[model samples]
Target: MKTIQYIAAVLCSLVLSGCSDFSDSINTDPTRPGVASGTQLIANAALYLPGLSSSPKGEFMAQYLAETQYVGTSLYPQESTSFYSWYEEPLMNLQAAIDSDDLDAGEGPIANQIAVARILKAYFFWNVTDRWGDIPYTEALQGSDNFTPVYDSQESIYNSLFEELKAAVATVVEGDIDNDIIYGGDMSKWQKLGNTVRLLMALRLSEVAPARGKEEFNDALNDGVFSSNEDNLVFRHLPEANNQNYWYGQIVNQNREWWALTETLVDEMKPVNDPRLPVYGNPARESDEYVGLEFGEEENIGTEEYSLLGSDIYAQDAPVYLVTYAQVRFAMAEAAERGWIGGDAATYYNQAVEASVEQWTGSTEEVADFLTQPGIAFEPGNAMKMIGTQRWVHLYMFGYEAWAEWRRTGYPDNLVEPNGVPVPGRLSYPDNEVFNNADNYEEAVQRQFGGDDDIHGKVWWDQ
Candidate 1:
């Protein structure tokens, strides 16, 4: 807690020095050309996603870009700065500006900004909780009161996020949608997304907190959640060449470096004749033949020989999907399995699979033909497995979700730990978290079962 206070003090000191990171990223600078507000800050916070899949963030996501672990591993690291926004001190501090001493009830109020910030905060904290487990949430984003805040249980954190999401959604009543950056600021979409987020969170906890998770899932379902693609929660990527794809910034630019599709992901798609495969992986190094390089194969051997997932999707640039129609469908399928709601598990699962095929190439028959096969057809426990597997495949470039889904469902059973993984799970908190916030860092580390953010430790929720 003291660390959070000191950090706050330092940030406050920085504010007086003429430049403050806290207010700067959020457009809090008064001298800027155009007047900025909380809406822009929410937008900037979401911007963190693109940078994640493409640059240093991409390397972290790829966890394979490096020559050392070329193929696969525990997925996320346990010791690097998985945090894309700790550096955004200004945005984190913006909350304080609103709750300050000098405030007018109606002069450029905090409603829109606070709503967006809460939603954005949910997204940001989800990344942390999704990756690390039981992060310092009640304490986090507080700037001072919560700095170095103790970690909460994963279950508690999930609950809190849902509450925050609900309140954020409520702030934007049905009629107000213009300011929404995600859906033309659509309040309905925001509300739908809020409920949809609730559904996803419940699904994540289904196996862990079946009862409470089920109740929450029902509430979200009954409340009306996203049902169509038009309601999908995503940030459209600009044709901006620099931000096209994380890989475009990292691999496509120079020597053409990309991770060969792991055999685990490859094999799962092969049996079902999944269409997305060709779109996801590169061809075998030897020829344009469609063959996947096994996950743990000797570094990069037979891979250069085969063509991976259809080249069409990879060639154009796959947009970063924070959440999608396919994911919601799969979650619904999982909910059915638990008998939490109406709908056949196999039915929703099949829809999810076909959704993947269609999502990749825009063809429903293609999906039908693929699902007609035995390996891909709807079966008892297999539905979730198939849904999870394809979801993982679709998540090839989208880092955190792929890793998080794996933790929950353990599906697509083919994913293999790479040859020389340094650590399992995500990287540790940033160096600054350790050096300056030593006590908090130490306590958080102790809460982590592995003594450090090692793969063996089960995040409280996962445990």
Candidate 2:
């Protein structure tokens, strides 16, 4: 079991050996093995899934956490961050697995392997397009044939991803796969993942394309979604040094006490006596209470004055949650409120809150009491606002997804950074694009933002 968990980490190092930077060329690591097994590629791709939720950049954008020392990220100073590592590493491996002709039924069904690869590829592309707006999709992964691939619009990418996810789900066959670190070859869980991702992706189109959003959401829900917390997509970190949680590397290994709960989050949860507060953070040293630092404050505040993350959160073997049942229920609640589904919004809302509480605290002991509170209870008048706010809370460490939700719904409308710069709608393109792929990059920027490739520009779906 331990060796199984370490397979992805091993493959990552082997595949990426001696590769300094992968941005210049389409083919990375020319010295590495060219024809890796489908299973090996799949394992390599799975390794990157944990970083999606654990990213500090995402946490800062979402305002769930703040910097205790160096506060550059909290102030949102990054104009361009690279997507090259994503494409070069996980995305490339997934694409290789999908395109591989190796038929080893002993490892797993070829159909199933391809299906999983396609699903993962679609997910990686979804993340990229959401962050960068326009990215190389159609012309990507062409190796030496195309060094400069044209950027696809976010709208086109989303449309293609919808089709890809549906196709991948339909392609699944009966078989357990080897080197499957995530679900241990549980095909049913993979099916649920496919549907749940499709459902969430569909909901993202609610504001911009309501009719299509309703159709896709209903389709995914009808097919199937996560039935319970058991079906959540989580990446469990290994205790090994190479596979340790990202937080462990920062706080435990390096002795860096740089992160704390943000005032925006602590105030909201503490005031409501949110049960997850204790599980989310430790009490401040001076106050002996859960205290959050004002986000982006330039003052050299004492680290002991604010709450640090819970011990379990930074543990080496901690599990990173990619998606959860609570998120699905919240989506259902919103769909119900939008008249897109045949269910009571309050019932789903209540279920969502209960699930979130259970998921965080590992028990439902406080759920009944928590729900009855005047402010916590569902109010029909403020249905959408309530759903959005509660959903934001449910998405504690899953920062990028939460940030994307905030952009789409504009709920928790009180997120004010004291620095006076409004939260960005999307990340700017990386410098590699600006210099290497200048023509295509400039074209994308001009088409999307009227020649300005800044973080403030909104994507197609942020209408």
User: Once model 2 is optimally superposed onto the true structure by TM-score, how far is the C-alpha of residue 425 displaced, in angstroms?
Assistant: 0.8
Model 2 pairs in collision: none
Badly placed stretches (over 4 Å) of model 1 are 1-31, 51-78, 82-113, 142-147, 174-181, 299-303, 308-317, 419-423
- Tens digit of lDDT per residue, candidate 2, span 1-463? 7465465557555655223234566665666555566777777878889877888889888888888788876787757888888888888878777766664778889989888888888888888888878899999987677989999988888889889988988988888888888888888888889889989999999989999999999999988999899998888887878788999999999998888998888988998899999988889988889999887876867678899887888899988988899999999999999999998999999999999998888999989999988779999999999999999988989889999999999988888765788888888888888889999999999999999988888989998
- TM-scores of all candidate predictions against the true structure: 0.81, 0.95
lDDT of each: 0.58, 0.86
Model 2 spans > 4 angstroms off:
8-12, 16-35
Candidate 2 minimal-lDDT segment of 10 residues: 15-24
Candidate 2 TM-score to native = 0.95
For candidate 1, the lDDT comes to: 0.58
lDDT of 1 by residue, 339-380 (tens): 888988888877777666666666777776777788777778
lDDT computed for candidate 2? 0.86
Strongest candidate by lDDT: 2
RMSD of 2: 3.3
